[model samples]
Structure formats: C-alpha cells, structure tokens
Target chain A: MTRMLTFLVVAAAAITIAACDTTGEQAMVPGAKYSMNVEDGRFHNIHATGQKLACETCHAGTEYQPDFVTLSKYADDGGASPGIVDRAACLGCHKAGGIATAWYGGRATR
Target chain B: MVKFIRMIDMERCIGCRACVAACYTENYHTSGAPWNAVIEHEIGTYPNTGLAYMPINCMHCEDPPCKKVCDDMGAHAISKNEFGVVLIDYEKCDGCKYCAAVCPYGVPQYNETMMELYPGKGRTPYENVSDTDRHPTHRKKPKVMEKCTFCWHKLEKAVADGKTDRIGRDPEYTPSCDVVCPVNARLFGDIEDPNSAVAKGIGAKKATQIKKEYGTRPQVYYALVGGDF
Candidate 1:
C-alpha cells in the first residue's frame, strides 16, 4: 500500500511540473521579455479613445521613407529628422487641455 | 590631461535622432548595431504626463569595468587613451563578449559578421571603405565587442594636426552626434579644464553621471535627465 501511494504521488508531481513548463496560457510578446513592467497584454482601445492621436503625429520620423522636402539634406534610407523627440515635443501636443484628463491607460486600468 | 567627457543638456535636446543617423553614417555601422540612441521615457500619468528624451551612449569611464573584466579574462583588448578615451585594440580582441556581459549600461555591442547591404548584393557607398585609412574606426571585427569610441579617430586626427583646441568646437574634431545636434544640446570637451564650456555647463546645471553606486565613474554627464538620486 505504501509503495503504491509513493508511486502515485511521484507520477502526479511529474505531470504538474510538465504542465507548468509547457502551459500555453501565458503566451508572451516578442520584445516584451526586455520590458520589466508590462505583463502578458498588448491591448488597444482598452479605454476610451478620449483623445486618440496618430503615431506619426506626435512621434516623428516614424514614416517608412524620409521626408526630403525640408531645407536640410537628409539621407533617403529613412534617416531623416534627427532632432525629433524632446520634452518640448511632448508639451507641443499634450499641452493644457490634452493633459487635463486622467488617463487610465486607455481602459487597461479598469 | 584632457579628462575627456561629454555633457548632454536635456533642457535643449530635442531627441531628433539625427545623432543616430550621424553615428550610423560615421561608423559605417550595419543595421543591427545602433551606436547611439535617444530613449523616450514617458513620465507621470495622463493629467501630469510628459516625455524625457534621454540620449545615451558609452560612458567611457575613468575606470572602465569593461576593460577590467576583459583584462582579467586574459583578453587585453581594451585600453584607455591618454585623453581618457577607452578604446578596444581589435587585434588583441578575441570576440569573447565578456565586456558586454559585465557592462551596466549595455554599451558594448557584439557582431558575429559584417552584414552586407543586401546579402550578396555587395556594399553601399558608406559600407565600401577599403580605401579609408580610418576604416578601423568605422569598421567592426566579427564576433568582437564594440562600442562608441567617442569618435576617438576624429579626436586623434585633431590632436595630430595641432587642432586639439578644436576638439569639441570643430565639426572635424567633434563626434558626429555632437556636430549634427540641431539644438546644440550636445557638448564635448576637457572636463578637467575649468574654463571649458562643458565644465562650466556641468557646474552651472549640476549635471549627474549614472551608476556612481556601481563605481563606474562614467565620464558622460547629463544636465537634467537622470532620475533624482
């Protein structure tokens, strides 16, 4: 009886270990491992699109190709706009009214 | 003693990433390796939110941890120039990546092979550097640990030509990142010289260096970017 009970316990423990290792429940993102904060979710529209802004609008130089219309000579292979992001850049859009709302991560907070 | 160092003023920096393009072109770096980066970190919540453009590169410390560990591992590839520039002697390097593993700031980038512009499609204009004498500064050895030279080759030329005074002021002597900055946010010069602009600026703004707790004593100073320590 004792031997049989020990064998059963061992088998159950092994199965649990295997299940934990290969479990598909925690499907992770590619570059997310490098991030210390975010966990398991990359949801969009999780909150009110209270003030949705296009990516390229605030975040500059994200366009596929470089914009060559400016006075400065920029190399074509997507290397334009070296002076794109700064503290002032944020205040440019997220100014007085845009920052007034309490953003709860677009609904992820709830 | 130059005590070479860099100062980045967050107040003026616009995070344009021209520094990135400048580094890429100047170094002849392939796509995978990014020598300079402008880190955009969002601070506070929606009502109080703002962004900080933190441009980072090699610290080029007074006592570099990368050099210490590499030498201990019997690879004496890393050496500091007289002007306090930390350099890697490529011939002595064995591509161990030990320096990369030990670095706190993740400054060292490892390359396994020289990447072509279009895989068997030959090289680009920037990539083709067989004739350039400064190829050592621009090119990388496969499987070796490489990081920012602070554009040491440019500085070396400036010094050799008796233009040491022009190190930080001139485009030829200044690092590409410093020269291309649209806002004049980047400042490089002899930190030891109290009269120099970089030194005075550091003093006036109360610039701070990262990882003093780790005792790396990084030469790179930021005016108002590092979190309150």
Candidate 2:
C-alpha cells in the first residue's frame, strides 16, 4: 500500500510539472523564448492563424552545420524529424524585406 | 591559362582511405575535422544493395558560395584564385562560421583548439615542423576555418618550376591524394585543354558534377557506377 501510494504521488507530480511547462499563446512572437528542440516545440503556435509554415521551410535537404546555434532533432512521434537549420534557410524568411524582422549580425532591425 | 580539375572514379574506388591518409600527411588537420573524407553511401534496394565510396575534398567551385557568403558578411576572408581555387585567408576570418553555415557540402571546418595528432604522446615530427618551413596552407591555427586548397602549394611549385604542362604527369605537381591512389581512381589535371588527360577522361567516363542544382559549378567531377547523375 505504501509503495503504491508513493508511485501515485510521483506520477501526479510529473503530470503537474509537464502541464505547467506548456507554452502560452503569447510566447509565439519574434523574440519569444522558444525552444529549438522539436520534441518540446511550440511550433504549432507559430504556425497557427494562417502562418502554415511547413517543416521543410527551415529544415530538410541541407547538410550545413552552423556553430552559432545548437539544433535539436528530438521528436516524440515516429515521424520524419526535421534536419538542422542552415543559415541560408534562416535568411529566406529572416532577411530584409522578409516576413520576420530583419535581424542578423547580433542585432534586430525594427 | 590552365583551369585545374580533380576527378574521382567511384566505380574503381575500393573505399581504401589511402587518399584520406595522404591528405593528412600533406596537410595538418585538426582532430575532428579532416580536409578530405571518403563517405560511403548505399545505392539500390535491400535485394540489390551496394555501397559507393565518395572521396570528397574542396570542390573548388568556379563560383564558390563560401566566398560569396564570407564577402556578404564583410569578412572578406575567402578568395577564389585565378586558377579557380577557393582559399580562406586565416588572418581575415573571425571564426563566425557564416561560410560553414552557408556551404551546402558541409565544408569549411573550424578548429576550436590545436590538438596534437597523438593525444598525450607529444607532437609528431610533422607537427613539430617550424611555421616558416610550412606552407601557408599547412600552417593551421586555432579558431579559424580550413579546407582543401586542391594542393595549391604543389600547383604553385609546378608553376614556379615551369612544369605547368607536366602537372598531371609529375609527382611533385599532382595532389598527394591523386598521386597516392593505388588503383589510379583519382586524376588531377588542367581541364581547359580539350586534349588534356583529365578532359579526355571526363569525356570518356561521362563524369558529372554532384549538387549542380546549387549552381556553385564545382570544378571537381565524379564518375559514378552508372552514367552521369
């Protein structure tokens, strides 16, 4: 009975922690604290409301390895994991006259 | 007026890393990143699966993306020589790795530290050579990008010796990787001359450049098992 009660308490705590770690809708902005890890991704929020950004937009068909940022390929689902993001891919949407803010060279242009 | 080109016949390649070892002996590479690598990939289905070895060095593209990216970032570190060999000026590079990030082939490796070839065994005699004695390409430093020069040091020597016509035939003029290939799988020569050995070999084998869609127009060509890819 003691062991069963202990197991139940630990399981309940884990569930509570995971629920608390969920990202809110407000964290989908440009400079938000987003996780690069696909497993813990809030990409759905970024892709919500007519965004419709595909996974291949930033990843796939690339072998570039950047030293600036760490890329994660973690995925819980048994799906095709996204490849590492090349800076060229980032420039596609992040450069001047693009969708996102023109941010590069250690600063953001508003 | 010579345009150098390197060719690899994949069908004849036995996956023997002799070319890779020859590169290390010729160039001082960091611990993790090598100037040359022989990658093995599978072709065909499970029933008809076969492996293919691709020995890759710097393609020395005619319009190198690494140079363009470096110039765009105001680095001005990379330069394509008259011979169409892409080289990085280590002094100008700040190790930002922007070139590394933009390269489709994953060339341009950054050396974090000057690790000895043998760990805890002290520097090898090759590594202990004075910097003055070493060629600029072989003088590797920490926190900078490095890649194959297509053995420009040898090519430069060939030019100085007035043996430009005998590059592919001369041992001192040819790239160490090509010279060391036991199976004669690798070839290096000027592709400008329609009568040159490399030009003839490429035409006869129907060799094609890989990743041509990137539009880098790499000078290196590969003779795959089948026809051009």
Q: What's every prediction's RMSD, in angstroms?
A: 15.7, 13.1
**Model 1 over residues B1-229: C-alpha lDDT tens digits?**
6778899988788779999889877887765666788888777788988777888889888767677656655677888778888888777777666566446676878776788868888887656667445557565767676788999989988888988778788999989999999998888998878888889889988898865545567889988753632
Supply candidate 1's per-residue lDDT for B221.
93
Tell me, by TM-score, which candidate is best: 2
Error of 1 at A52 (Å): 53
**CA deviation > 4 Å runs, candidate 2:** A1-56, A59-110, B226-229
Tens digit of lDDT per residue, candidate 1, span A1-110?
99999999999999987665454223322122222111322111111121234445544656634333443454454644454244234434323235522111111100
Number of backbone-clashing residue pairs for each candidate, in the order shown: 11, 0
TM-score of chain B only, all predictions? Answer: 0.93, 0.96
Q: After best superposition, candidate 2 residue B193: deviation in angstroms?
A: 1.2
True contacts kept of each: 0.00, 0.02
